[model samples]
Target: MARVELYVSADVEADGPIPGPYSMLSFGLAVCGTFDGTRFTAPDPSERTFYAELKPISGDFDPQALEVSGLDRERLLREGRDPAEAMRAAAAWVKTVADGALPVLVAYPLAYDWMWLYWYWVRFTSRSPFGHSRHLDIKTFYAARAGAMAARSTKRQMPAALLSARPHTHNALDDAVEQAELFQNLFRWGG
Candidate 1:
């Protein structure tokens, strides 16, 4: 029997460009759908999801980055969830969503979100739910499918049908769900 693949869309909000120097303020994951050898199945993207806000690991943060995230560092320092605990819960949630299927992380561009998630997972728990390389980039997927230049394949350039109706709110969870919709559309597209 062919192994089933679960696509989990992810988004991250961070205080700085890199992980260790700043911090990942929050992140979210939404199970977009699944694919077996012969077919793709899209369930409600909001049905199985995970989100967390974490305390900063360092005292340092870029003002601009923090402003973009809109996460109060002082508040997080006082009330955010412990990073280790949050990461563990996220891992378990991913496994539960997978339910024996192989879980594959999905993101718009994949690089930034994957970097933060993989780093945090390994740092906090010493393991990652999606493993090191089981992932997909929706942007690249769309580029390849549409036969468009990767750099030129931003959402604005895509056909309206392929875009999600939800606005990019920059709240990790909301963006993740929106991204899940984009993934489902991209995955099922024939062109």
Candidate 2:
């Protein structure tokens, strides 16, 4: 029996910096690759994915953050899905795509995305599919694998081969897919 891990690239668009004080307006997940202890298989970014927009939990939000995402707070207030239902659906989707493999969340800088995701998972679904700590930070992973200083791990500093071809549009799903490509590239990169 070999250990299996599903690399899920997740991106979140939020109203503010923190979860409790603000809210995660939308999120997207794309299964980038899978590793079965020995080898990795990269998937098409559009293959298996999930996206959701949730109603705000709090009235307070940073105007600048909202601007970054280009999501209308007023529209979300009127049309967003319930957080609990959205989280449950997302968790179920993760499980379905993972198909018994351990699902590991992957993000550019896990700090910000993971914060909103983990908090929302617990607050809405009562548990996280990634089990609280199983996450990959792309920037950090690249820094460690490439022997670059942590502070200098920006995409511009990385090799051209490891960067995604897609643009970093603020749309959660688009960014998730873009990051999925990035994750595949980084996973295939050798020391």
Candidate 3:
């Protein structure tokens, strides 16, 4: 078993068409054990997933994504914390609760979380945790490993044998799971 300290997974609900140039709505995190020769199958049980929502600085949000999230604006305003506060709380929890890499699984281009976190941290404290510039793009790695399996589009492809049902995009945790599935597929195909 490869001794991995920890593994963390994060999902961000963005306020814009995507995750930049606007604001964030909510963020959730799931923490697990590192590789352990099982490719991070079993997460540490003590610290489960934590979900947090934030109030937008301006209420002008992307209506389409909003519909997808199904978040109630009024409820967010009532319950949401400021972005800085939320990020700080998130950082605190991650630092204390997680024990893996500096950053967690984003299932996206690093820029997505980088920008959101940069905006919040700099706006409040003038710093971003991602300054070091180390990140792993799962699809990129998978495509490289699965050169012949390339589907010609800039999206991740799961071999039919690996999928449980159908592919549903945009749901954060679901996407993360799908990405993991793709990685596993690549590993299996390689062997």
- Indicate whether candidate 2 or candidate 3 has the larger lDDT: 2
Off by over 4 Å in 1: none
Report the backbone clash tally of model 1.
0
What are the Cα lDDT values of the candidates? 0.93, 0.93, 0.56
Which digits, one per residue and each the tens of the lDDT, describe model 1 over residues 1-191? 87899999999999988899889999999999999978999998888889999999998889998777788999999999999999999999999989999999999889999999999999999999999999999999999999999988999999999989999988999999999999999888987
TM-score of each: 0.98, 0.98, 0.68
Q: Write the per-residue lDDT of candidate 3 for residues 73-188, one digit (tens) a residue.
A: 77888888877777777667766664544544444444575566556666765654434343445445556665744444144354566442426455555544444444444445
Which structure is stronger by lDDT: 1 or 3?
1
Per-residue accuracy of model 2 over 1-191 as CA lDDT, tens digit each: 76699999999999998999898999999999999888999989878999999999999999999889999989999999999999999999999998989999999988999999999999988899999899999999999989999999998889988989899999999999999998899888994
Model 3 sits at a Cα RMSD from the real structure of 4.5
Model 3: lDDT of residue 118? 55
Work out how many backbone clashes candidate 2 has: 0
RMSD of 1: 0.8
